[model samples]
Every structure is written in C-alpha cells, then in structure tokens.
Target: MVSIGLKGLRHLDQKPTLSKANRNSFTNEYWKGVRVKFIIQAAAGGISFMLLFLACSCYLYGSLYKSHQRYHNFRILAVDYDGGVIGKALSAAYEELKRPEFPTLYFHSPEDFPTPSDVYQIVRNGHYWGAIYSTKGASDRLEAGIQGGQAATVYNPNDALYWVWNQQYYTTFAQSVVEASIEQLVSAARAAYTKINGTQAFPYVAQSDPDAVQAFLNPIAATVANVEVDAQDSVFLFTSISMVMPVLQQFFFLLALNGVSREHQLYSKMSVRSSMIIRGVAGLLYTFGAALTQAGYYWAFRDGWKVDGNQFVLTWMVLWLLMHTHFTYLDAISAITPISRMPFAVLTWIFLNISTTISPLELQPGFYYWGICLPASNAYSVLVTIWSGGGDNRLYRALPIMFAWWIVGNLLSMAAHLRACHLAYKFDKEQQNNKGDGESAMGMTPVGSEVTIRPHSTNESAAHDDLQQDKTLEEQDLEQRQIYGPSIPPPFA
Candidate 1:
C-alpha cells in the first residue's frame, strides 16, 4: 500500500509547466483555498504572538518596577556595643535618620550579640542582609587613649564601627543599599561626637594629644567586612551568562533536531515512541557535553579561583540538570507549538529568567517571588554559591527545585510524544479508510481494510487497470503539451 501511494505521487515530485486551461482552472478552483489557508495562518500567528509577547514584555518590565522603593524589605541588624559617648551618639543618630529607600535597621543591644564576630556570622548565615555593630569599649578605649596623651597605640578608630554584609548575595544591592545605609549610620555618629566634644579644650588636645585629636575627628570610621566576596572578577562573567548560554544551546539543539527530523521524515518513518526516545537521549547527551564544555571553560579561566572537587562536580551537575530541564521543557513545548512561534517562546524564556536574576527578589516587587521557583533562579543560586565559596547556601533547597523541574519536563515530553503517536496513527487510519471508500466508488478493488471494502471481480479488475494505464498516458501527454505547446509536440513523438 505504501509503495503504491509513493508511485502515485511520483509525478508530484517533479515540476511541470502549466497550460492556459490548467492555470485558469487552478486560479478559479484551488487558488482561493490556498489564499484562505495563508490568511488564517497569518491572522492566528500574528494575534497569538502579539498577545504572548505583550504579556511577557509587561511581566519583565514590571518585574523590577519600583525596585529601589522596596529596599526597606531588606533587614540589616544594628548592634550598638559601645554604650558610651560614641554609642549614645550613634543610637541618637540612628533614630533621627530617615531615608525612605534605606533598609530599616533593627537595633540590638551588645548583650544580644556578645562578640563583634557574631555579626559577621549572622550576616553570612543570611539572618539579615547586613549588620551594623560597634565593638565593646569603643568609646572607653577612645576616651582613655585621649586622656593618656599617648593613646594612639590603643585606639583604632576603624574598630569603633563595623558594617558586615556579604557582597556575593547581590553586589549591586550590597554596595548601593546595605553599604550606603551603613555609611549614613557612621556619619550620624560622627556628627553626634562633634556636638558632644565641641566645648572641650580642643586646642590643648590638638597640641598635647595628637592621637586624641585624630580619634576625635575620625571617631566613628567604618570597618566594612564583606564575608562572601566574589571569588574573582571573572566570576561576574561566569555567573552572568549562566542563564543565557544554556538556553541558547538548548534552542539551537532543538532547532537543529527538528530540522533533521523533518528532512529525514523521522516522525513518518519511525514509530513515535522510538523517535521520541531518540530525541530525549540525544538531548541529554548534548546537554551533558555542553555542561562539561561550559564547566571546562570556567575551570580553564578560573584566574586564581579555587573550589573542592565535590563543589566542582556539583557545579557541573547543576549545569547538566539546568540544561536538561530547559531542553525537556522546550522539547515538550515544541512538540505542540508551531515552528514559526518558537522564536517568541525562546525570547520569553530568556527574558523571564534573566529578570529574576538581574536583581535580588528582596529588591523587586512581591509579584517577582515566583521567579525564585524558576530553574534559572535555583540553578543560578547554586552556581553563584559554588563560585563565591559560600553564599546563602540555597543549595539545600535549590537543587531539589531543579531536579523537580527536570522530572516534570521529561514527563511532559513523554506524554507529548505519546499524543503525537496517537495522532499520527489516527491520521494514517483515516487516510486508509478514505482510500478504500474512493476505490470502491470507482468500481475497483481496494486493499487494506479488514471488512466492508469490496474487491472487484477478475474482469472488473482488468478493466480498471487498463483504464488507469490510459489515464497515466493521457496525463503524460498533457503535461508535455503544456510544457512544449501543441505546435512543438512533434519532437516528443
């Protein structure tokens, strides 16, 4: 049956010149159908693309809207251990400070955080975005050093105020908001100290106690300790492209796979299950290599970066999982989506993923919280953690999120493949049924149906074959006539 169908379609594989009558008939009878097909396709494609892109564009645009205004959502702990003149001045200044965009500081007593080092631990632990703490006896040490007249050795002004934050969390926010607020706190303390010491014998202190004068002027200098600093400058490139590179690779592979499948007629030639399995395996293999190559590239250019073997493996594993998740999801979506609309899907995927990572969720509006659930967010969280040595340690939670996405994506792809197989089977069955019915109407034998398809008698079969031969010859002659014109047909004869 397949051989017969191919033989019948052989002529359609070749281009033939059109006669005047054939052209008129095609223009009158078939052209309208073709035009209507294109029209419906254009309208549907345009409308759907516009709606999806507009919604996605709005989502990405709105994701970070008024981000600076949401700065107060970030919490920074303030521990005033210096319960003397400096601490009192800092406390009063902290109260009077009012910057709407600045993070609201939560002040705690020195008793809450016994040692100044505890502030670094809490900040690195992700308890708060940052911490502003003063050391014990910051004021007393300064006062004693001032009175002794040779107290420069005992008094380190930078030790008076310490701001602890992790730059690895989000460098922009860490520097702009968290550090900015810390600077303001330090400035407030400075103003308050000058107010307290204005009446003192400044000339006497300046001459006899040069150290005290220096301490008095710069009493509340800040000691910034960025616990989770980036490993190297190249790390910025490594993490920034983490989302884009995988997605681009996935898109390119899917497109290439689709093109190959269409050219080879894989879907029509192979069973649906077999083809889908091949595609799935191919995607996994490609992602594996891609992940390895990407990891190798980073390793090659580490530029003094270092990590344990386990961490290195985990980084590669995260990349593999992330790429796999992206591939399976795209494969499933592409199975149902038209090729023309795929560009829009890819763009939407990339933009939505980047919108979440470009800034921290705490800085963005609440609606962007779902961004954390996305694969890019989790994968990036794990990657940055690996690169920065130790960040918020979201790996405990992010790894599982990526794994879940990979599992769900594979399931969806499998289901879509099954649906495709079912649809293909139905289409083949309908074509066979229609062929049997048409042949029966022509009083000829029909092969392929188990029941109700009439087979012609011997005489009827012979007559039908002769008639088909005659029709074939007639078509050949007509096509030649159309190509060469009636007057030039002598050459063929």
Candidate 2:
C-alpha cells in the first residue's frame, strides 16, 4: 500500500499543479490585453522611444564621427594671386596630392577675389572652414630668391587663416590639415625648382645632405593663430556631459510632472486652492530630490564633486530651479489643455536633441539656432560656463532666462488653479440650488420634516400635479452626482 501511494504522489507531482495552471492562465489573460487599442498605444510609444534614442545617439555620435571624418573632402578656400610657374606648380601639387582619405584643396581665384575682410566674414559666417591667401608677387619673389641666390630673402607671401568659432573641433582639425598641406606643397615646389635651376632655392644647400634636405623640405612652416570669439577647445567629457544634461532634465521634469498630476487627481475632491498648494509643494520636493540625485551622479561620474565646489553648487541650484519650472509648466499645460503626457514627453525629447551642447549651435540652421533660447539650452550654457571656469559673467547672463521661465510657469499654474476653483464653486452652488428646489417641491423641510400646504386655485393645483408627475429634484441631483462623482478629469480639459 505504501509503494502504491508513493507512485501516485510522484504521478501527481509530474502533472501540472493547480497553482501553476492558474498562473499560466493569468499570464495568458494579461498578454491578451495587448491587442487592438493596446497594440496601437504600445506601437506609438515604442516608435517614440526609438525616435528619441536615434536623435540623441545621432547628435552625440554623429558630431564625433563628423569631426573624425571631416578630413575627408575638407574644403579650403584658396585665393591664388601668384600667376607664376612656382605658384602654379605648388597649386597643381596640392590638387594632385589631395586624396579621398585626406583634405582636398579647392582653389578659387575669381577675377575679383574677395578681400581679406570678405574672407574673414565668409569664414566667420561658417561659409568655409578656412582660407589660404597667396600675395600678388609670391612666385616672383620665390624665383628671384632662387636665381639671385638670396635664400634668406626668399619668402612666399602665402598664409593660412582659420576662423575660430565657439566649438573648435572642426576648426582645429581643418587648420592642422591645411597647414600640413601647405608645407608639403612648399617642399614639392622647392624640389622642382632645384631640379630646374641646378641649385637649392630656400635652404641654399645641396639636397644630398640629410640635414640640408630636411631644411629645404621645411623651409617655411605654417603657424595657426586663432581669432578667438568665445571659442574653447572641445573637451570630450564636457561635450558628453552637456549632451547628457538635457536628458536628466527631461527625465526629472516628466517624473515630477507625472507625480504631481497623480497627486492632484487623488486629492481632486479637495478644494482647488488646497490641491494647487499640495501640487506646488510636491513639485518643489521632487525638484530638490532630483537635483540632489543628479548632483551625486555628477560627483561620482563627472568628477564634479571633486572639482570647483562653488561652481558645482551653482550648477545644482540652476538645475533645481529649471526642473521646478519645467514641472510647473507641464502641470499648467495639463490643467488647461486636453493634451496628454506623451506629447509633453515627446517635446522634452525634442529639446534634448536640439540643444546646443550636442551639436554646435552656430553650425545649425535658422530654426535650430533659435532653439538655443530654450530653457534646456540656457541651462546647458550655464553648466558649460561653470565647467569651463568662464566665471560668473557668463553664468549670470543665463540666470535671468531661467528665472523668467520659473516666474511664467508659476503664474500660469496659479491661473489654472484659480480657474478650477471658480468652476468648482459654481458647480457646488448649482447643486445646492437644485437641492433646495427638490425640498420645496416635495413639501418637506430642509430638516427632512413633512410640510402641509393648501391648494390656492384649480390652475395652481393642476400645475403642482404636473410638477409631481415630472422627475423629482432628488433624482436629478442624484443623477448629477453620479455623473460628476468619483470622476477623474481627463488629462486635457
């Protein structure tokens, strides 16, 4: 008997248990919910996430990759005024040596070539990366120096000028490439001249000697001098941190907004004034918490904690204020409009992708350049200034913008709350009037006591009978309560 019982127990264990079956059934039902409308929403959310991910990734990786690949097909404006043999030879060598893997020289010598100031303006406007100018008698000077044996006096009035923008990655890279190209061309031209004239030109030494050859090859080197207009070197960590700043802001803003919205819904039955106050307080707390959390992140990963203490504190405060304002703005939007959280989330993502830190703001086109005035952009500017030790001058310039956003958002939110309060009061008053009417019609006192009344005339009695036949005021009030009670307002009004 014991053996048989054990065999039965083993068989029962091998079979699917009731709990397991129930869990399986529950999972199936849960999965079944992901159909039709659920699928549409899920698909939309998935697409939005993908787009946001791609935009951010493109901005970060695309900028870096473009900087790396900028040497390929890099365009440099060349204004050649030396229409001589040496100048032609050097220009031809530059063009021939230009490769797909290296920068290509585009020589432009229009009849009316742009003046130096024009070239400066063109570069400043980002029309070209840099410009090379060869003076009118460059080749004449070179040939005369070679034939006259005036090696020390042999100089080409050719120069490379680069426009220095706020972001120096592309400018610096282009400058280096162009400078190297100019040196190579000079060496090639000198070699050709030596072969034709049977004498060294620049170094005034025989090409057979190694030191002499080196000197001849590098007779004159190009020096890059930047015209600084608030330009700074592109630090990888700083750029990366700036790109990440907007993401943190968007996340915390949405988080706080969603939390406040939910809190408001839960306490919606309370007076509007109380609800607004509670939401405002919740927003402040969440902003503070998020700021602290971000500060920790910056300290641990960005080395912000170990760096300048005052700057870090200032950055934290700015971030806190910005987040608070952003959350308040979203709350106000929700209160006044029928727009949902998804749209706001998408807008935040847009701001993150378009901010100046991810890509050079100056390089962007018109609409994108305008995006620099956004709150995220302002915050990025402040953080970058603090990080770069640009002092309080730059930081102060951005503070006013942040403050403005805060004030505007708070005012709009307050207005929404006041409007809600007014509506609620009106609704409550209407309900009270309906209740009073119901009591009068039922001949009952407000205390729920029965009241007796005498009929005045036949016409009055008939009207009263008709009123009794109609739906009672209590029923109407009950219906109104049913319609309005336990209802959470839509995200959009």
Candidate 3:
C-alpha cells in the first residue's frame, strides 16, 4: 500500500493540477500581456456598464417609488346637471374631502353640463379618474321619497350615475373614496332635511320591512364597471412585478450580449456561422434561465404555482419567446456595434420601465400612449390576462404586437450582423494586402538593384526618428483591441 501511495504521489507531482496551470498562466510573460489587455478592456467596459446600470436603476426605482408615494395626485370630473341644492351639496362634499397631504381626489365641475358621450370621451382619454352625473330632479326625487315613505330613485343611469374609468391600479382606491364621500353627502342631506322639517327621514323597522326611509336617506349609489380596460387583482403586486421583471430580464440580456461580443472579438478568426450558433445558444440559455427565475419568483411570492396550469404554462412560454428574441437582437447589435450596447441598453430599459405596463396607458399623455404598443407593454397585458383570468381578447391583441417585435428585431439584427461581417472581412483583406506588399518590396530590393545607404542631416534624422516613433505607436495600437474592438466604431463617433 505504501509503494502504491508513493507511486500515486509521484504521478501527481508529474501532472500539473488545474490551479497550478492557472497560476502559471497568470504569471507567464505572454499571458501577462494578455491579462493586461483583458484588464484594460474590462475596465473600459465596466465603467460604461456601471454608468448605464446606475442610470437605469435611478430612473426605474426613482420614478416608480415617487409615483407610489404620490398616488393621490388624481383629478376627478364632477358634472352637476341638477343645478339645484343637492347638486351643490354633493360637489361641496367632494371638495371638502380633498386633503393635500394624503391621496385625495380633486373634483372639478365643467362650466356647462357635458353630454354622456363627452363624459365618456373625457374619462376614456384618462384626463380624470371618473365623472359624476347628477340629474336635475335628484333633489326633488329624494324629497318626494322622504315625504311619501317610498324608496328614492337617486342613482338612475340616465341621471345620476358615477361613470368611473375603472383601471385596476389607481381607480380602485379612487372609486372607494368617491363612493364613501357620496354616501356621506346623502346622509348629511337627509339629516338636514329632517332637522328643518322636525321629522326623521329614515326610521328603522323590522327585518321584513321594505326600508323605504333608509333608501331615501342613502340614495347615492355607484355602479363600478371596467371600460376599455380590465380590472386586475392584487394591483400593487402586479404593477411592481411588471416593472421589476423587465428590468431583470433586460439586465440579463445585456450581460449575455456583452459576453458573446467579447468572445467574438477575442476570436476574430471564428467562422461567422459558428459565432452565430454560439450566440444563439447563449441567448437561449439566458432566456430559459431568466424565464424560470421569473416564473419561480412569481410562484413563490405571488401564488403563481396555484394558478391554472394551462394559463401559467402559456404565460411562461410567451415570456420565454419574448426574451429569446429580444436577447438574440441584442447579441447581433453587440456584434455589429459593441460600443452602442450601453446606449441601446439604457434606451430599452427606459422604454420597458416607463411604458404603460405598470400604469394605465391612458393616464399618460397622448404622445406616450403610443408606447403602449411596444412589446414590453403588450407582454405585460398578456401576463395580466393570463394571471387574472378572462380577457382573452386582450391576450389575442397583444400576441400580434409581440410577434411583430420578435420578427422585426431578429430581421434587423441579422442584416446588421451580415453588414458588420462584410466590413470586417474587407478590413482584414486590406491589412493582409498591405503586409504582403511590404514583404515583397523588401525581398525584391536587393535582387533588383544595388541598395544605397544614405546618411541624413540632423533635422532629417530627427524627422525620421519621429516618424519611426509614430509607426511604433500605431503598431502598438493595432496590437491592443480596445473594448470597442477593431470592427465596431466608438459610439457617436
């Protein structure tokens, strides 16, 4: 056994371990040069990456956080067709409820009574959270009901219905507040009428009683309906996840593209097909990994695993394909214009995060609403439809937009890659021709003619020496490929 152990030790000594080989590579003079180049490249890339990361982080987190903090900054439109005591009372009630310090709804009354179609258009445009319509007979109807011991018809859809543009996120909170305020206003009006007339507007009765007086005193009612958009459950969680998921996905894609681009630059002699295959494989892995991670996160925290299996699977597949196509485009962009990676990354981050995924697209200005058609925005719509159930039509609509992005991004990326490869090949061939010409001239000089050695004047020699130094600097530059690589031009240059 000791002899065998000694032989094993000798064999181990003869064979270099991976760590030893790595250590030697680091210390080796040729590898030291490579290491230095790598560090320089890494440093340049790192600084640009850090700048872009900080910008994206600041914009995303800062804007989202601030919006959350200031969620109360919403305006509501109130139309008083009643033009009577009760109309003024309801408007005053809403006005009184407005508190600047908290999330409060500000109610604005138009100078003239707006038609129902006008109200709908205004709300649809998302200028206000909702609009309240009070009919001319609202006060008279309540008074007649109170006097005749009958239920008041206060919330007629033709007269006094509150049409709320129900978005799942901001509208829920705003709706609750509006409903509560209307109830309070009605109660106060009933109490005032009773005090002046010396009688109770509503008197409690047995369980079997129709409770006409109670209805009269609390006549204000609301019908909450979603229009042009679907209501979402768990609004806060859904919105937060929508923002975070895209940021994480884009970050992973940037890393994958950057790595693949560096690999291509270092192995410039790699066949184009092989390089594309490697990038495609890397993008696939990244997309799959990111999709799994996002899905797992949703499952663990958002009860996604308990969701309908088919819907969950479909959502996951959609997310995966979206990321795969997006990353593939990024990989091609990296290959074509590596220096533009940072700018493109920042632009994409802004587009995904600032778009309508986390909020109502209608709430944004008209110009920004166009961004709702972007792939990220459409993806969020599909995600919400799948997660919350229903809205098959929305999912269907979003599908075409997603497909368009996938197709367009891939096509543009491929074209750019082909162009870049052609340029690189042309550059390489020109370099080879220049080198061959220099070699041929040197070889033919002695064979074709007697070579004369000429002595230069001091000024001429100085100029020649300077030219030699410039040539050495150019050679050194050619040896060191900057982070942009030889093929890619510097950004904005």
What TM value does model 1 have? 0.75
Candidate 1: residue 387 lDDT (0-100): 58
lDDT of 1 by residue, 32-148 (tens): 778778788989989988898888878877877887788888898988787777777777777777565768888898678888788778887777898887778887777766554
Query: In candidate 2, which residue ranges exceed 4 Å CA deviation?
Result: 1-203, 206-213, 220-289, 292-296, 299-307, 337-356, 365-367, 391-401, 419-493
Compared with the true structure, all predictions reach lDDT values of 0.73, 0.53, 0.54
Clash counts for all predictions: 0, 2, 0
Query: How much is 3 displaced in model 2, in angstroms?
Result: 30
Q: Which candidate, 2 or 3, has the higher lDDT?
A: 3
Error of 2 at 438 (Å): 15
What TM-score quantifies how close candidate 3 is to the native fold?
0.52
Which residue ranges in model 1 land beyond 4 Å of their true spot? 1-52, 197-206, 231-241, 263-276, 300-310, 428-493
Off by over 4 Å in 3: 1-237, 247-254, 257-261, 264-268, 303-306, 336-348, 351-353, 423-493
Which window of ten consecutive residues has the lowest lDDT sum in model 1?
483-492
Candidate 2 lDDT over 215-283, as tens digits, reads 344433233433322233433444445445534564445444444344343333576667667767877
Candidate 2 to truth, TM: 0.49
> How many residue pairs of model 2 clash at the backbone?
2
lDDT of 3 by residue, 1-493 (tens): 2243655765754454523654565667868668988999999888977877776566445434434334345555667766655566555555554454233444445454456566656655445555566665766665555544433323232233444553432434444543444445444443443444324334432223334444444545444434434333454665555455644565456654544464445234567777556655766777787777676666656432236567757767877866766665554555455454546554655455454565554334344556667667777667755653443236557888888878887777656556555655655565666555554433334466876544447445645554453435455334323332323332333
